[model samples]
Target: MSKDQTRRRILEAAGPVFAEKGYDAATVREICSRAGVNLAAVNYYFGSKEQLYVETLQYGRDPEGQHDQPLTWPADAAPEDKLRLFIEGLVRQMLGERAPWHRQLMLREILQPTGACRQLVERHFRARMDQLLGILDEILPPEVPLSRRQQIAFSIVGQALYYRVASEIVKFLVDEDQRQAHFGVDQLAAHILDFSLAALGLHPGLAVPRPEVTHEPLEP
Candidate 1:
């Protein structure tokens, strides 16, 4: 196999292994075996097992080769639209071309988090929290604690993605129709968008409603 193919094979193999075994418990030998590649190839492509593991769990951009289209975040797009894109992009990236393993691998990392897990939290994920802090500040009153935004961010991401990660429990809790409907990413995104709109204290989707001007009646 070509060098690029070998590297990708290793990534795909190592993700599940890390997911299943946790980071420290996982071994390079198992990943190499899963990829059906030579030991030297892993070293050549990634330098070390630790490095390979980190790359596997990072907020990876999907490997689209030349055909990967960039998200067109129009200047006028609502913040909620951008948020949905971020959430959906994350979901798609994990699923890659293999949707079935997406939950298995993701749930493993979430439930049994490893030290390398912080690499993601420190990088894109933490930064995402910061952005939400800024967004929520715009909607909530100035008197609200600075910590509230960060907490809200955690709840939003945790609520939406964890539902997908822990789908078996969700399936058990909900009726068949709601479960089937939310199984698709667009439908999932819609549910999340509605929650986010409420969190932001606004109407949702293609239109953001005008605020009603309510005046209190004068004392009679």
Candidate 2:
């Protein structure tokens, strides 16, 4: 295989092993073995186990991440629509190509964050949050504390992630496979917009209150 092809094989192989075994437990030898590449090939491509882990995730995230720099939405679009596009784009990135092990890998990373995870949070996620908060400023009063603006942003974000990250437990709680599957990111995105409107001290009759910020930011 060509060098790029070889690298692709290694990253593809590494994702599941890292997820099944975790970052510390999973070794380069094991990932190489699974990829049918010699040990040296990994060092040749990624230079280290940590970088290889990043390559594995970048495979899925790069498309979005590459284009995911802060956006200035159209002058015509409403703040609500701007918020919706940002969220929909985010959900697509998280659920990229149904790369499921990413969710497990993410849970592992979040529970016990590595240096790389910290960088990702600082670079990718925090950047998004800052941008989202700026847009949210129009609807939310300026006097609202940064904590509460974040709280509002998190509510919108969490609604988008619940199905992908916590659906197994959520499915069991609901006890309906059909309903569980239907509880998709699209529906989550739609629901969150309504939730966001209510959170800015306005009452939307019959809107369910968000319980609390319990789960960490789901993959996106």
Best candidate (score: TM-score): 2
Residue-level lDDT of model 1, residues 81-187, one tens digit each, is: 66777667655544334644434544555666656656554554455566556556656678888677677777777766676566678778888996666556666
Distance from true location, Cα of 55 in model 2, Å: 4.6
Candidate 1 residue spans exceeding 4 A from truth = 1-12, 19-21, 24-27, 38-52, 55-72, 83-110, 175-178, 204-220
Deviation in Å, model 2, residue 71 alpha carbon: 6.9
Worst 10 contiguous positions by lDDT, candidate 2 = 60-69
Candidate 2, residues 1-220: lDDT per residue as tens digits?
A: 7978888889889989987788899999999999999999888999888888887766644523564344568867877778778877666645455656765676567656776756654565667788789778876767889898888788777766665567578767775775546556676566566566666544453345456637766776
Instruction: Give the TM-score of each candidate.
Output: 0.61, 0.70
Query: In order, how many clashes per candidate?
Result: 0, 0
lDDT of each: 0.65, 0.72
